[model samples]
Target chain A: MAKSTIKLRTKEKGGKIQVKALITHPMETGLRKDKKTGKKIPEHYITKVVVEANGKPVLTADWSGSISKNPFLSFSYAGSKDDTVKLTWTDNTGKSDSIEKKVGEK
Target chain B: MKRRSFLKGSIAAGAAGAGLAAGILTPNMAFADDVADNPFKAKSVDEVLKMLGASGAESSDKIKIKAPEIAENGAVVPVGITSEIPGTTEIISITAKNPTPLAARYTFGEGAVPAIKSRFKMGKTTDVIAVVKAGDKYYTAKKEVKVTKGGCGG
Candidate 1:
């Protein structure tokens, strides 16, 4: 599967750079009815997420069915000289995706 | 369909008479009692996400998000985010693409740690998003969560 997209932005002097990422997937909460068959939908959800800067992991997340589709994530990292960050995620279906971003220090 | 009609019909019944109002009110009150703490409302993840303005493009890595490998209960899965980055402005939003994407939204000021933890209901299996804002930038982290039968009332 394709990895999620990570966006890094420049932070102010002594400011933290903001990083945002999004992955495309159906966060299927097996609760609603199928539009066609009118049957309850099967369950599908993501379970874990991790983030690293210049290869050093910094943030992680745990999730459930309550989350929305095509999960979106936002967080911050100490403005670093490394200029690169990595991200990874795994789902309940034994699926995983990861990506990396370059930070702009302007 | 039935549930929607039931909700509307009860509202109509409540408007009919004081007696009917009392009668209809009892069930709603009972429902509130039944789900006094069932934070789950039947909305798709997309709708919830939009409602909260939690688009990840405006998020940043200054915040840290933590979640579990597997959730035993869909109704009460725990999620956490902490900002170790400087100039942290605000931390907000949780989305699960199951039944209503936007779970919750939080706001903070500069220098605020912007760390938060909360329980959310998952309609099924899906990925979750933690969107945070630092300074003038936005960041996000995502995790996939698996829900077993024991979690939701399955």
Candidate 2:
């Protein structure tokens, strides 16, 4: 299998779970022109991101191409150690990737 | 062959009826789709807010936006938003001068916090606005970030 495009980490501190994710994508806005080709780059960016904790959706984000390339996201939730956290993102082109991590795990 | 065609027609009609019933039973199902429809196409912050079902937002001090007053590079400006208001269900960030002003929208569930940190691209100097939805009211905060360089490619 190809390497995953998402890197996720979850840590439990003071009975709260901090989730951080880094996703690798170009996040093209379709307005940029290629320097060499002088052609516009087609728009391609993540449209939706869903973060679930133990099978329950804790956060749902809708994003546009204004987000920087190689997006980094950090948020927290009220969760305990050993709980599972899953993050999934779908781009405008229908491409998607997901990753899961267990809280308090290295 | 006639009998088979008749059965197929009946099945298709029944499926369509069931779908219509489900759509009517869950109005939120349609509302969710409406909310997700082309929000990025909005050219201004007001249009984006309208698309999000918010009429207008009042300025508030409880919403804190953390961003540099002057950014050397427009390619990546780190921003953090924290809403002190209780029962915040949604948070939206917009770059006022971008070609498309709407940047990101986040909906928090029961166990989630109403805060996030992320990076956004700035074409030039612009006002970064944060909108927070608590209960049935919407509040907003704004911060100006001067960009020395443009991030969008020519």
> Per-prediction TM-score, please?
0.42, 0.85
Q: Is the docking of candidate 1 incorrect, acceptable, medium or high quality?
A: incorrect
Per-residue lDDT tens digits of candidate 1, residues A1-106?
Answer: 5333333343323556566656666766766557788667777777667666766655555565655566666656565545576668788788877766667532
Best by lDDT: 2
For each candidate, what's the DockQ? 0.07, 0.65
Query: For model 2, how does the per-residue alpha-carbon lDDT over A16-89 read when each residue is reduced to its tens digit?
Result: 99999999999999889999997789999999999999999999999998999999999999999979999999
**Model 2 residue B65 distance off true place after TM-score fit, in angstroms:** 0.2
Highest DockQ against the true fold, candidate: 2
Measured by TM-score, the strongest candidate is 2
What are the interface RMSDs of all the models? 8.8, 0.8
Clashes of each: 77, 0
Question: DockQ score of candidate 2?
Answer: 0.65
Docking model 2 quality class: medium
Please give the lDDT score at residue A88 for candidate 1: 80
